[model samples]
Target: MNAPQTIIGQSPALSAALDHLSALATIDRPVLVIGERGTGKELGAERLHFLSSRWSEQFIKVNCGAITESLLESELFGHEAGAFTGATKRHIGRFERADGGSLFLDELGTMSLRLQEKLLRLIEYGEFERVGGSSTLKVDVRIIAATNADLRGMANNGQFRWDLLDRLTFDVVRLPPLRERPGDIEELAQHFAVRMSSDLGWSLFPGFTDEAMETLKGCRWPGNVRELKNAVERSLFRWGRDDAAVDEVVVDPFANFAGPFGGDSTAEDLADVSDSPERLSTGLPPRRDWPIDFQQCVTEYAKAILLEALEEASQQQKVAAELLGLSYDQLRGLMRKHDLRTRPPRRVSNPRK
Candidate 1:
């Protein structure tokens, strides 16, 4: 029953997407929304529904991945009483509830082949029979399917139905990930900060310092805007100082003084890390090499460790962050600080419908 969130961003990548969505909104056909997690696929779907001629009708949402196949079928198509073991009463499905409106199916790739067929039939003919029900029901429902998965690849592998994919692709709305729209990072951060500030009953929202904004902009938010919003709100809440500018954003709450290796990081852990027997014997110089540049040695050692971890994790930043016991942002900061490149920044062109 929840409405879609407000879409915020002035970046061309986002603006173009919005414009494309607006154009497609009036066309009452199945639309596929593709994007990484937190890229506002649902919001796009909501806009499509609200702007359509069926704006006054229901906007039902279903996460295909969250429910099991059998339950999902029943949920989508409804069921008569005694349809299954738990069917004590007649059930109304999402298709029935979403009659004359929009039905947003999230994680569409997770739907089973059988359900996909039924869905395809419904889309094509605008009619379907509920589970264990003899009566065929017809409903004028617009389909808005969203997924982060590779549906084309899945169809190629026979995991998803090509026919279903074909039907759903009457139009496609590909949302740009947060990394692709870096220009909006500060604006989003400020928006989140203000909302969080108001939640805390503050008179005025103090802004982020230059360092904090840099911290916000440095990392690739794999979870996209949702992750960024969490980081900003958490940093503001932890800062708890409304009067002063937020000088640090805690992108990773788990990061500690022990760097990435985040156990019970005591002083002993710190000393032991630097003064390990292997490090002293192989990595560092003895008293004879006391004149060695200490800072440079430490830098080289840190970089070596980081490189080793990255290699072990196959250069996946999130995996490397996990292996190093650091948050994604912390790992990114360390990589940047050490002048390490995991991979080149990728620019994904948003698809125009």
Candidate 2:
């Protein structure tokens, strides 16, 4: 058996789900885990198996929906050599391999009615016949199935076997979605960000700014924990500053984006500088009587363009340089000459602490 990692969350909804899972772990009967996508149904199954009496034995897993109907039967029940075309060697099935342990059947609602009948028999009688073999084989295996689909409703529609549903649903554990467990979002986001920072060879994770955390907390994560992790990692990568808190959270990377990298046309890019107040207007007076001081006007214009690019790039110096078509050294020199800084220098937080 593989060592199970901890699931990161302590919300009441999640705590109740874990408590229910622990209660059913010792029963040795089939269990059904129901949850939406990315809600950690597979993790729940792992917890169930590892905590059960069969923890020392094999814990096999198969996705019923991922395989075809014809192949699924042979996969669950071993096929004898020459059982069909290309069946050269005797193939042991998941049930046989999981004997005396647990078998996790994910996407159980997708199993065909015929295969469901065979599975029901195995659960009830603890015996099944391998494909192309006459003798019956028996195994003492516990079943732990999971699905996002509604199995009971499918059974009512004749898409699933009613008996199999009844056998599998001896106990059901439903995981709460991320939005329902709002208190866990910050911790989960920090955990993901810290791991991402480490992968990028950073000594510390700067963490999120107040505005960034508020943006994360206010959003409803439709894709749940997985979505939140992706958003956090993506935002940090785009921010590209390990020494500063992330001030932006890009929940949807594709929202309103155009061109190659969600950028406007090159001409439009230059318009920010062109439309500045310091730019010579079409209604300028005679050259000798012009009211604006040329040197001061030029200095203010450069500062305005620099600040605009910085704001557009979320204060990322490298990206702001790219936006202005300036080299990194050139941008640094400009900022130094203009007495400008993105934000006050702050100490980076030790992620380990």
For TM-score, the strongest prediction is: 1
Q: RMSD for each model, in Å, please?
A: 10.5, 11.9
Sliding window of 10 residues with minimal summed lDDT for model 1: 344-353
lDDT per prediction?
0.82, 0.81
Model 1, residue 45: C-alpha shift (Å): 0.4
Q: Candidate 2 versus the native: TM-score?
A: 0.72
lDDT of 1 by residue, 40-96 (tens): 998999989888888889999999999999999999999999989989999999999
Off by over 4 Å in 2: 259-353
The CA lDDT at 163 in model 2 is 77
Give the clash count for model 1: 0
lDDT against true structure, model 1: 0.82
Pick out the ten consecutive residues of candidate 2 with the lowest summed lDDT: 344-353
Q: What is the TM-score of each candidate against the true structure?
A: 0.77, 0.72
